[model samples]
Target: MKIEIWSDIMCPFCYIGKHNFEQALEKLPFKNEIEVEWKSFQLDPTLDAAQPQNTIEYFKEKKGFPADQASQMIGQVAQMGKGAGIDFNFEKALIINTFTAHKLLHLAKKYGKANEMEEALFKAHFIDGKNVGDIEELVSLAGNLNMDKEETRQTLTSDQFDYEISQDIQEAKNNGISSVPFFVLNGKYAVSGAQPAEVFADALQQTYKETVSPFKDLSKEGGASCDTDGCSA
Candidate 1:
């Protein structure tokens, strides 16, 4: 079975959703047969650069949330993340445009390291508080993943993979998606938000059963068939 996940690196729920999905996969009997593809979805495509404000400040100043509300919201999300094994440090996170980071994901997909790339990017932003929008930081991240750092830097500097990023966004739009951590299973089942691990596991199991069923006695049908006492053979 194939699963396509549309998420932005900046989305806290996306990180948590990833963990939930992984936990679900661990419980699946056919986990080894499942394939996951990561797609790009930017929270702010028009954002040009990294804002000077941290997450709390961005929520208060840019999003117009009250200071106390912003802190409470982030704190709630951080607590949720902790349950999923994520340690979010929103106070140090930088609000940056993720277009280039999405592009790097496309590049990583080509080399079959998309999962690694996604995990690294999420950790950098929410945990390590690295500027994901910066070319230097991105290149360094690529190097740490054993990818070609110079090649990644050149790709980020240029307009490479720009169309792929746009296409991913357009695909999300065509699917009527306006949120991150959206999951599509077998091009049919759609799961929104950071659902529970059991929900994901059930979806996977249902889709797998639909895709491939165990052997059944087709000869014991309602139609005319051969039998020891019948001439309707």
Candidate 2:
């Protein structure tokens, strides 16, 4: 089974949800058979670097949520992350145009270091307070993962993996994605939101059952919501 996750690097819930989903997969019976492919979904495709606002202020201003409310939300998310064994320094986060990050991710995918690069980016932004949009930061991340720094820098500057990023975005649009942390299981089941770990575990167990017992019957299901357009058998 394959799990396709459409998520953004700067989205706190996406980071927390990633950890929760990973934990669920770790304990599932069919863990070895499942393959995870992280898809690109930029929360801000048109972020102007000139303004350069912090993430908390950005969300508060954009969503009309109070600053205190936003802080509480981030605090809850960080707590959830801690429960999942990941620490999220929501304070140090910056609003980044994730297009270039997505491109670099695809470049990392080519070298089979995609997961490492994703983890590095998450750490860089949410933990280390690094500027993920900068080429220097990206090259440093790639070098740490043993990738060629010069090649990574050139890829970031030039049109490297642009096509891949476009295609992934198009796919997300076709699926009617309106949020990050969206997950598609086996290209059949769609789940939306930063779901609880139990919800994610249930999803994997269900997918595993379908894979192991194809002839077994199943039924329509409904949770809080689906990732995009509603999922069916």
Candidate 3:
């Protein structure tokens, strides 16, 4: 079974959804047979990487949320993250363009380190408060994942993987995906948001069964077939 996840590193719920989905996978009997691919999605593609803002400030100034409301809203998300074992420091989190970060993810996908890259970026932003939009930081993060730092830098410097990132976003738009943490299982089953572990587990199991495609003969009589009673005469 294949699971493709559309998420943004800056999205708080994406991290939580990741955990919830992982937990679901853990409960699945065929977990080893599952293939997970992380797809890129940008919450603010227009934001300038050069001029980053704190999360609270972005919510207040850009999204037009009152200061207190912004803090309170983020606080609620932080509390939800805590339940899923994420330590979200929204106050220190930087709100920056994730285009470069998403591009690096496509690069990481080539090296089979997409999961590591995603986790590193999430921790870097939510916990360490590192600026993911910074090229230097992205290069450093890639290196930490044992990826070729120079190659990663070069890829980001050029227009490489730009189409892949854009395609992912375009596909999301086509699929009516306007939010992060959207999961598509086997191109059929979809689960939105940071649902509970049980909900994800159910979706995973359901998709697995639906995709298995059980063979049905529909014939009433057996025709020269072998069975537990031995070959039919």
Residue 189, model 2: lDDT of 91
| TM per candidate | 0.92, 0.86, 0.92
- Supply every candidate's count of residue pairs whose N, Cα or C atoms clash at under 3 angstroms: 0, 0, 0
lDDT tens digits, residue span 1-233, model 2: 99999988888778778877877788877788988888998888888633456768877877788998988888887888887678887777877787778877888888888877888888898988887888888889999999999999999999878887888888999989989889999988988988888999998888778877867635455535456788644
Tens digit of per-residue lDDT, candidate 1, span 35-151 = 899999988776657554588777876789998999999999999998999999998898889998888888888788999999999999999999999989999989988899889
Task: Tell me model 3's lDDT, rounded to 2 decimals.
Answer: 0.91
Which pairs clash in the backbone of model 2?
A: none
lDDT of each: 0.90, 0.83, 0.91
Q: List the candidate 3 regions with Cα displacement exceeding 4 Å.
A: 214-233
The count of residue-pair clashes in candidate 1 stands at: 0
| Better structure of 1 and 3 per lDDT | 3
Query: What's the CA error at residue 78 for candidate 3, in Å?
Result: 0.7
Which of candidates 1 and 2 is the stronger one according to lDDT?
1
Model 1, runs deviating above 4 Å? 50-52, 214-222, 225-233
